[model samples]
Target: MPNRTAVHSELYSPDSADNPSLNGGRCRSCGYVFFPPQRYGCESCGAPPEKLEAVQLGGRGTLHSYATVHLHMGRDIEAPFTIGLIVLDDGPAISSTLANRTDEGLAIGDRMKSVLVTASTDQAGNEMVELRFAKAEGSK
Candidate 1:
């Protein structure tokens, strides 16, 4: 197998493709948890930036909603890709690209888990993997 690299290194680690962890932030003052971590003040309360602490959130979540894109203009990805809004078990809802190319058998409230999918290959022959959600095993 070729070497692998994460597309968004800051968001998640390049390893643990089977069971990934999300880089999130929590407000020390208001206990607000959020993903795609930021250094800015808490959006829930008026907590200062210093009160925000980095956290490793579980990559498991519930599929709240989803949509399939049939058309695309971007060069990075093609059309017929699916995006899902998942509410993490820890807290906060995040919209992420789904591992499935299309939303065929997907349903709301399905158990979801994170997985790394090969987005592209780097010039140095490294696989660029990106985090995406998929229906959990044995989940109906």
Candidate 2:
């Protein structure tokens, strides 16, 4: 669970799991998709801000890029972990952590799915939700 203020406004709520996925803004004028969902105006075609709509993103994506993090800035999550960018199947690319790391065989361009996880905790001890990418089951 995450407090409204504790959650990233640009991201959807992890708990909802229904409508709560990354919200993207699509320009009705040019069909441009904006990740982090634009609030006021469109960066492309100068579309009016009112023309943008909130679009729920698909949880499936391809592992665009990744790296094993030996260190991190936050204490809530353990270090020596893996993080990467997932280019959603129908949305913009987002940076997220890999669900499980096994020396077995993780590679780039692997297909993955989004899973909700605890990103960190607030000073008041509220858990912050985040999206993590995991290799799709049966993927090798």
Candidate 3:
């Protein structure tokens, strides 16, 4: 068994065999996966919304692209952070605000893994958990 502290938050969906990903949607018609869940329909095939289903996404992927944020959005949002798209092995590109990781010395196509991070705090003094990507430990 894995030894770790469990965080209580809604950053992702409950871990279930049916829907493992907290924020992933898959099109039953076209097999296209989406991050942030497809509530309307398939973006690629324009299928009926009913054809979309929720899914649990794997934690590993390759860095498809990225950009550095120079401007600040809010005090909760840190500047000089990197944001990027990761191509998951399950066939979806997930956008994440990279945290505790650097864009330096890395390139597109490098292996990366998803991580849960405490991005900020809520008004109630609660930690806001977020999913971010970092270079896979074994990757260059």
Best by lDDT: 1
Q: Write one digit per residue (lDDT tens) for candidate 2, span 3-63.
A: 5332564666656532246677788888887677767877888878998888878777788
Q: Best TM-score goes to which candidate?
A: 1
Of the two candidates 1 and 2, the one with more favorable lDDT, higher being better, is 1
Alpha-carbon error at 6 in model 1, in Å? 1.3
Candidate 1 clashes: the total is 0
- Of candidates 3 and 1, the better by TM-score: 1
Error of 1 at 33 (Å): 0.5
Worst-scoring 10-residue span by lDDT in model 2: 1-10
Residue pairs with backbone atoms closer than 3 Å in model 2 (clashes):
none
All candidates: TM-score: 0.95, 0.75, 0.75
After superposition, the stretches of candidate 2 with alpha carbons farther than 4 Å from their true spots are 1-6, 16-20, 101-104, 119-127
> Model 3, 115: alpha-carbon shift in Å?
0.8
* Cα lDDT tens digits for candidate 3, 1-140: 22222153333732332222445788999888887675788998999999998787777789999988888779866687889888887777878777544578778998877776655555666554556677888886
Model 1 residue 37 lDDT score: 94
- What is the Å distance of residue 56 in model 2 from its true position? 0.6
lDDT of 1 at 56: 98
